[model samples]
Target: MTEPVLCPADPAPVTLIGPPLAPGPLVFLGDHAGALIPRSLGTLGVGEADRRRHIALDIGIGQLGRLLAEHFGATFVSQTYSRLVVDCNRAPFSPGAMPEVSDGTAIPGNTDLAETVRADRVAAIHEPYHQAIADLLAGRRAAGLPTILVALHSFTPVYAGKARPWQAGVIHGGPGSDYGRRVLAGLQGVQDLTVGDNLPYAFDDTDYTIPRHAFPNALQWLEIEIRQDLLGTPDQVAEVARWLAPVLRDAMEG
Candidate 1:
């Protein structure tokens, strides 16, 4: 028998903030909101500095998601484990899901992992987080409520020594991303704000959450990425959230 990836004392794989409100069009997701590695993993052979970096999780997204959930009175579903353990946003079969190296940093514990060990992480963390999202969406559908899924994420200002120019990015593609395009256009119109229309990263086969949940339901969805530097402090996060709330609202009504 395999050892459990998460012990009873550990946090749940999924952290749900706010309750689902009927007829509410928003359901937010923070796939890399946390930086927790299971107690069993013991840091995955990563140093403290590296663990605090974007490779471990999406910086400031937890605060941002919570604030957004409060503002919109919508459910925010978030993953609690660090991406280094098992990237919830990547398919379990993808090598990038449990990377041996990320952005030049070596993950010694993940190097040459056994299939069973990998499966344990997938079953423990990846499955439950997504299942919660699916279950919520299903309940909303049964109640005849409309849903507009929004995936929140953050990226490092510089990747592999190259500086990223976009202050924020909106990713939209596939068959069900009409709403995403609208959001993208809306953000682009904002003065003095550099918004990327699928810049930093594009929505593609490598992505898991949005495609898995949104595509099948033909749901309106937007994957938004904010540069980590802009989200460093509490005031900055609040300011960004305040600025973005109207943009999302306008996109929905437009």
Candidate 2:
């Protein structure tokens, strides 16, 4: 049996914001918004430098998601724990969800983890964050409102010692690829940006959030990845948000 990873009074695994019934058709999610390890886990035995790396969180996505949500009055849901603890964007049972190593950095706490320990992280953090997304989407459906799910994320400017040139990526596959394409088209129109169709990474079975909530329901959706270097400052985040908000709005409207 999986032992309970959280004590009786841990903070909620998800942070839900914006009005539940916001007027827009958009719903935002930041699965890698936070980089906090539980007190009990104590940094998962990793160095401070690694803990603060892109493997821990999606860099500026939390603020970007919030700004988009606030701009559109859409519901925003984000995970509250670091992806190093348990990646909320990955399927609970997938290896990436509780990876022993990420982007070349080994996670000491995750090494040779017991099944129960892995299960506990899933139950404690991953499950609740996704459930909150489901609940919000269900409520929107119940209210007879249209929904367009947007999975917000950030990626390292360089990975595995290779420099990636794309400023951003729009990822989607299967029946949902059209919406992603529309978003990509809007982004491409921007001056001096090297946008990619699925550059940084593409969607696959390992992606839990969009596949679970957006794909099955036929909800129009897009999984967007912004370059982490572009989000190093609050002003930069705001600039990206400003640039993206209208593009998304235009895409959805068209």
Candidate 3:
């Protein structure tokens, strides 16, 4: 398998596929899809070894987003820069903001960022991706469809020396609904698949994506995390999309 790139290019990295102004009842986001680092910022003091860590980007999510976009015909917006450059999933004020060190490598560039430089990142990259999201929501609302938010992500198989057994994790914001549960229930018994209602990282009101955007908009939300290895191939992505399509339809109708 080809190694995932550490980051993409600078100045509004990443790509938005499907429609930017679609009125689908669903919206898709891939926060850590980019693997490019900005030239000005450079790689955070982090070394080559650390950049490959889960800290960079959620591996395989780009593929999954493509599959999801095709399967659901939902507008998908994904990040193109490395998460080490700036965690797209994190709140702007959260300490993970511009992490100086990740996965045991000190990100040289991230240490002690100047106020102006930090704001540049927030404005140059972060704001545009989110604006795309806001536009999707606005379009959905305008069409009188109850929007359902689905954030695509992938996790490493092992972290910090501990083995992670979950093949997929389906996370819901604090707000529980049948949408989240029914999807989980549908994926009943795949071999070697251990599913977590919420695993690896949980969500919260203070610092998260689902609730921060979805709830306030009165949208249904489900955050899905596939083990990166499971989604490493195109076949895997297609299989997942095929499997989930009907399940999502059921959830929508339910």
Candidate 4:
């Protein structure tokens, strides 16, 4: 028999912010928005310090996504569990989805995970999160409303002791990443901003959200990454959103 993924007591896997029928053509997603683990998982045996790290969640994306959605009058969908439990951005059953180790830090909870446990995580977390996104977009399409999908994320300023220079990055892949490139150009036009075009990382084999919801539908989309340091406080979060919201608006309009 297949084991269940989440306990009956676990919180909902996805959080939908803003109105379902918001004004804008944008739908923002934060795959690693929260760092909360199920009470049963017990932090995946990780320490509090590591639990708060990037391996657990995208440091400030929850706030960032919320702010952008509010400013743009767009619908925002986010995962409220830690990526360490099951990365929503990755394909189910993929190694990166439930990484045993991330950026050289060992995840004790992930080690030697049983097949049943892995499947449970996917059933509980990954499946629901993606389903929410897919359903939201489908509803929009059925209503004949224009849609632009944007995935929000934050990256650690330094990884494995190596410092990264760009303040922000835009990840695009394949021929379908035209909207991503336009977002790159829009942000680049901002003054005093060092924006990387597919720097630090690129959208590739490990990405599931965009491929599953955006590309196949041929939706204009972008996966945006902000340096975690820039999102250290509420003011910082607003500052980034203030500049970024308009950039995205122009990208969609242009």
TM-score of every model versus the real structure: 0.98, 0.96, 0.87, 0.96
lDDT of 4 at 64: 94
Each model's RMSD to truth, in Å? Answer: 1.0, 1.5, 5.1, 1.5
Model 1 ranges off by over 4 Å:
none
Segments in model 4 whose C-alpha atoms lie over 4 Å from true places:
1-5
For model 3, the stretches where C-alpha displacement exceeds 4 angstroms are 1-11, 20-24, 189-192
Candidate number that wins on TM-score, 1 or 4: 1
Residue 19 of candidate 2: its Cα lDDT?
Answer: 91
Model 3: number of backbone collisions:
14
Q: lDDT per prediction? A: 0.92, 0.88, 0.73, 0.88
Sort all candidates by lDDT, best to worst: 1, 4, 2, 3
lDDT for each residue of candidate 1 in 1-254, tens digit (9 for 90 to 100):
75688999999999989987545799999999999999889899999999999999999999999999999899999899999999999999689999999988999989999999999999999999999999999999988999999999999999888999999999998877888898888888888999998989998889999889998999999999999998999999998998888899888987
Report the C-alpha lDDT of model 2 over 1-254, residue by residue, as the tens digit. Answer: 53357665667788988997887888899999988887778789899998888999999988998898889988889888899999988888788988999988899989988788888888889998988988898898999999888899999988888999999999978776677788999999998989988888988777888888987898888999999999999999999998898899889867
Predicted candidate 3 versus true structure: per-residue lDDT over 1-254, tens digit per residue:
42222234444655778875455566788998877776765566666756665788887788778877877777778887788766767776566878877766677787787776666777767766777777767776777766778888888888888888878888765664457777777655445558877787566553456656787886678887888777777888777777666767777776
Ordered list by TM-score, greatest first: 1, 2, 4, 3
Between candidates 1 and 2, name the one with more favorable TM-score: 1
Give, for candidate 1, the lowest lDDT window spanning 10 residues. Answer: 15-24
- Candidate 2 weakest ten by summed lDDT: 1-10
Error of 2 at 219 (Å): 0.7
